[model samples]
Target chain A: MKGTFRASMAWLHTGLGLVTGWVLFAIALSGSLSVFREGISVWMRPELPTVPVQTVDATAHAVAWLTDHAAKSSAWYLAVPNHRAPYVFGTWERPDGSYIQKALNPLTGSPDGIRDTLGGEFFYRFHFELQLPYPYGRLIAAIAALALVVGLISGLIIHRRIFADFFTFRPNKGQRSWLDAHNLLGVLAFPFHLMISFTGAVTLVTMLLPWGPQAVYKQDVMAGYTDLDPALESRAASGKPGHLTAITPLLQNAEERFRGAGISQVYIYNPSDAASLVTVIAGNNGTVSTLSHSLTFDGTTGRLIREHVETRPAVRTYTFLYGLHIARFTPDVTRWLYFISGLMLTAVIGSGMRLWTVKRLRLPHHLGHVLTDRLNVGVLGGTSLAFASYFLANRLLPPMSPHRAGHEVQCVFIVWGLALVFALIRPARRAWPEMLAACALACFAIAAVSSPWTNPVTQSTALVSLLFSGAFGYAAFRALNGKAKQT
Target chain B: MESAGTLRRPLATAGKSLSLKRWDLACRILAALPGGYALAAFSGICLAVWLPGLRVERAMTGMLTGLLIWPVAFMASFAVPDGRKMLGGTVIALLALMGLAALRGWRP
Candidate 1:
């Protein structure tokens, strides 16, 4: 019975991994890129330079600017300057329910006339949304995450030699080498993979299983979300007009109360109204809990309204899971660690696909086997090329081009589609090297085309580009030199 | 090697039941989807009721628990190797949870 159970798990792992491997790879790779989303945003906007400034004063200046220009706005969100993002960002909702976001110059407290590109937000959104309309795209991504959980669990259960094969990396053995690398990557970061997949699925749990909340809240799920994160709590705008009080004192009070924990976001609800209130939420840099310690102050009188520090175990567990998944509390070194782990996860899926094809290739004239082999190339190679093309397109496209961000995303899909076509026409052996070489060239070019030494963010971007270029080059070389043996 | 032949033999026998295999695949797929989802929700709610929390916490925890367990339920539907048994086990669990909830008036 034990042996049979292992066999059943092996079969389950193979089927589940193959069926959803492509989508999982795409999600993981994009998420890996998004680890440096803020840096990428800074790099994309070359005009923004890093500078040292007090976050409290920056928020005060941004709020001052908003007071003059958006006195009647319903609400205002102030993102204080930090290391990754060196500019004060503000977004406000108009009376008509539209929002305008702008980067305020630290010196001038005015909007930075940078290019209207999606910047890092594109990859961050595409990581889960896949650029499809809300709810449906999220739904599909959630289902794929579930598949990943099953794949991880079943793979763990079925593998017989866990410790023995921990350090195995036998190159040039083709399929055996791929399986070794796959197992090595999976086993090394098994905890990370399991945590990321499970929490990721839990992130969308309310949407996936609304019945629990519906039963409790009687169909008002928004209230559930608000309860989970009280920073989302809001009050309607009172029509009574009033003078706006200075927000600097309120922000200073929040900073004092939180004991120098950086303020990530400050929201002014019903600004310039009698009922207005300001809420300052703690930044993720201080702790591994996404639920920020918050302080709400009356907007009219600058009086402290409410203060909260999460103590509930359930909320703490949920937020810890969220924080672990997002990794927002980590420094640059730890962020890179996450990026590496994410890359290994993607490689695990890719190598599993390769193993599937290699095992099936021992047979002859099986359409399923051939198709899987081609798709293996198309997905693994095509997605890498698409990502490289996204960076290349971002650099090459005109800054003022209308729909510039959409076009950049379109370039990704277009090149990826072309790779698919190439995979169909060319032999799998030829397609691997060709697509990989193209990706290597593109990555190298992205690094080469950048200026020598502008800032740390740009320097880091260039370094990452070079690293990817070298990795792709090595993969291409291996594919070109290795004999295509069916063993 | 004859080992490859031996590995292929079971699949060859599976191919002999082409129509029956198709039916079995369809049944398992159904069981994995709806059957598994129901089982997850029922069991999740049952677990949530035992947890110490308020209404929102319990609801969120139950939803999270359901989401985490749904994948396990899905794989179990295929792992058991018998679609009927998988379906029957899920239904029985669901009914049992329902009985508990109905008898106890399950509320957060």
Candidate 2:
């Protein structure tokens, strides 16, 4: 009976190990790759010459420009450039107050052709959003994360000599290499693994517990928000046009109020009206999740309203934790650590799946092994192909072209599908090298093509990217040059 | 004293009826969910201060809530050895918390 129970656990382990392995690997790998989302964004956009830190006059500039350019705006937001960001971005309500975001040249405060880049935000959104319409993709990713968490926990319980095998990675022992790599990576960065799961769950807590705030507050979320950040009630003036002045004095006043910490944004509400307010959020650069401090003033008389004169306790705690999740709050050293850790997390999951498939090769006809092997190729190889395609799509597709994003995504899916097909149709022995070569070819081709695009990143950076792309191509060719080597 | 010890072993080790060590592990896992619910719910409560928008305030509150999920699980496991019923308890607690929040007018 005891033996039977153990056998059942083993069967359960094998079943899950085989079933969800590739999906887990893909998620981890993509997540790790996305750690450099910002860097990649920098590579994509063209260089913008730095402007003088003219934020003292930012609110004034916005008001002046909008008054001349966007008179009769109903809804508006003012975004001032900071040390980290290269441009000021904003949108205004046109008589009706709907939002329309645009990039402003801080020097002249005018819209330019290049103001369209969302940069790292694309990958950040893609990492979880998966581009599927609404809750479906998000729900799938969340369920995958839960599966990953359960697998990791069960793995720890099942592992016999966690420490003894911590550093022991034996090669050429069928599943040994993959298993060792998985165990080593997983154990070393176990904290990161665990945190990612829980925080990921935290990120999805709303979805997980949708009923809480829904039931209790009767959906008066705005009222609830008031409880969180206390706001002053500004009396609405008589339903008449109130004469207004420029926002220069108020801008300087807010800057003076912030003193050392620079002002990152200026929000002018009810502009040209008596009840108009200007909120200047002070800047602290290079942090995750952009919420900051500053002063909110009456844009009319420039009287001080709610001033974040000091670091409020609740706000500080909130920013710090968000920083941890986004890896933005840390210095370069810590950010690099997070990136590396994220990468290792991907490798661990990838190898874990491969190891399981290899171990299961003894099963009848070994169809499962064949499926897992193909899956491994499809996921890892397909990932490289997808990324390469994105780079290619970005380069080939017109920058101003409205369908650019959609085309790029299509390229990724198409390349990934091709890789999967190639994996399935070809012999497992030949598939690895074939797929590697294919990925390399795509990467190099894309890198070569990208040079023609007038992107912002420095030429030196692009050339280096090209060189690395070529290097990968060369390695793939060299590996496949010989007879196909089966694991 | 010996009889009491033996009685505890039957329930703790072999577990109830046909349940065994795997069941214990399952219990641990099951117990964890409710605790996680509480922890997350607490974080949700903190976030109500800045509802809808996942602003800095909400993010900070979320971190606090995220940490609670584990401890709640740990506590539930230690206090109630039964695997399934505590899950029921957790659901109740979560539902109640949500209902209370909704009753208070939390919304989109």
The top-ranked prediction according to DockQ is 1
Top candidate by lDDT: 1
lDDT of 2 by residue, B47-100 (tens): 554455544345445544544554445444434545567666766666776665
Error of 1 at A428 (Å): 2.5
Quantify all predictions' global Cα lDDT against the true fold: 0.77, 0.58
Error of 1 at A215 (Å): 1.0
- Model 2 lDDT per residue over A1-487, tens place: 5433333334434444566666666666566556665455545554444454566554455566677777556435766655444555667877555555565655666654552454555557666666677787676666566656656665554454567656566554444555667767878888888777655554554465543444344547665444334432234544456545557776777667656556666766666666776676666554343354556676567777786433555555545444456654556576667767877777776666666655555456477668767877888777767766676676666777764555667777898888888888887557867777777677567556656545434343356456646755675564465333324
Writing each residue's lDDT as its tens digit, candidate 1 over A1-487 gives 6655666667678777878999899999988888888887777777664578678777878888888889888888887878787777778887688877666766656664565555676778888888788898798788888889999988888665567557666677676677778888999989988988888887777667776666666657678767776655667777888766787777777778778567888888887898898888888867888765987777888877678788777677777888888787899899998899999999998888888887678767498878878887888999999888888787788976776767888999999999888897787888888888888899898887667657787788888889989999998888887745534
Output the lDDT of residue A422, model 1.
88
DockQ value of candidate 2: 0.11
| Interface RMSD measured for model 2 | 9.8
Query: By TM-score, how accurate is candidate 1?
Result: 0.90
